[model samples]
Target: MSFEWPWQYNFPPFFTLQPNVDTRQKQLAAWCSLALSYCRHHKLYTLDIMEAQESPVFNHKNIDRKLSMEAILIVFEELRKKGNLEWLDKNKTRCLVMWRRPEEWGKLIYQWVSKNGMVNTVFTLYELANGDDTESEEFHGLEDWMLIRSLQALQMDGKAEVISMDDGKGVKFF
Candidate 1:
């Protein structure tokens, strides 16, 4: 037996907000999951609302189905409040999504260093980012600010020390 569509109707202008809390919660959860996964996969540390590409809101193809900037901001703000994201600047134009927080990055760096027998070896931050000796799969092309922040966190834990190079163009980690 084959099933056939019994009802063929187009409902236009159904301006009704969902009143069920459970349904709304489920919807919100789904949206959040998509947003976070997108951010993580793209390594989008920062998101700018004015910049349409950075924001998940705004759809160029479907103008009628676009999400308002205010709505997008609300979702980002909620994420920030929950400690999942942070504003990089005062204007709130850019946001840093904490898929993996600084503390976790610090631990990972420490583990990598210990595992690779680089605990006491002195190396520049740039070297860590693009070094042939280091794990190219992990730290290559990583954001400098993120790497520095992670190193600083490790420093606080006495896991590593950051020193300024003589040239002032780079930093050495020991």
Candidate 2:
């Protein structure tokens, strides 16, 4: 699937940080939206600052414009404040991006289980993510860390329980 770039992406001025506070705020907002949409379309759960700077989303080769590293940091910082990103290191080079919150993912999983009448059934993490039954599901191909977080969200709501077994971890939906 191809990601559609926002209109701002092609605007050369959008690549630079604006001197005006209000303009900068609007610019940052646009950047945050673009970044989240791009990551979601690519199914990217993690991001590296250097890698992102080179990615098409931030680098508009057609326009010969690229967002400055400092601007990217500001955009990411905004995302973090909005609860959509989490830094993974002190250097802030790597981060986890949550386009959809764990609670939202948990709700989707729970709804699927209920709709399929699979409630009360134990399912291995792999099965939920990569099993044939879930191949056509949105959560299919979900990374284990994100999967665990989604299950944990469900557990907090008393809709699911994560079990650690000898073979691996599993989950039981209530």
Candidate 3:
């Protein structure tokens, strides 16, 4: 799906950083919303800020706008502060975005598994994510890292167990 930026996004001045604190705050908030929406729309759970500097998100084709690294970092920093994203590396290079937190995702997973009588059944990570049995589920095609996080949330409640394997991974719901 394609995303259409709001009017402010097309405004030439919107590409430039505002000098005033109040204006900059508003711009930052707008940018945060845009980034969150884009990630959610694309099911994108991770973002590399440095990589984004050269991507279409930063480079607006029609307006010929691009964000400087300083601006990118500022926006990303704000996002981190708000808990919408968290740095994955010490250098703050990449982030795990939370359009939907692991806790919420865990609840969805539990519901899906219960509906399918998967509770107390052993399932390889591959089966849960890519098996034909799960193709119609919402959590199908979930990234392993994200799935592990979500299951970890469930694990806190004693609702799931994750077992490591030489080949892949396995999960048993309880």
Q: What digit string (tens of lDDT, one per residue) describes model 2 on residues 1-174?
A: 577888888789999999999998999899999999998898999999999999998898999999889889999999999999999999999999999999999999999999999999999999999999998888888888889999999999999999999888999999
The TM-score obtained by model 2 is: 0.96
Better of 1 and 2 by lDDT: 2
Please, what are the lDDT tens digits per residue for candidate 1 over residues 5-60?
11110111111223586754554444455557666666666667678433433332
For every model shown, the clashing-pair count is 0, 0, 0
* Winner of 2 and 3 under lDDT: 2
Give candidate 2 misplaced runs (Cα > 4 Å): none
Better structure of 1 and 2 per TM-score: 2
Deviating ranges (above 4 Å) for candidate 3: none
lDDT of 3 by residue, 17-90 (tens): 89999999999988888888877777788888877787666667689888788898888889888888888899
TM-score of 1: 0.71
Against the true structure, candidate 3 reaches a TM-score of 0.88
Off by over 4 Å in 1: 1-26, 52-64, 166-174
Query: What's the lDDT of the predicted structure labeled candidate 1?
Result: 0.62
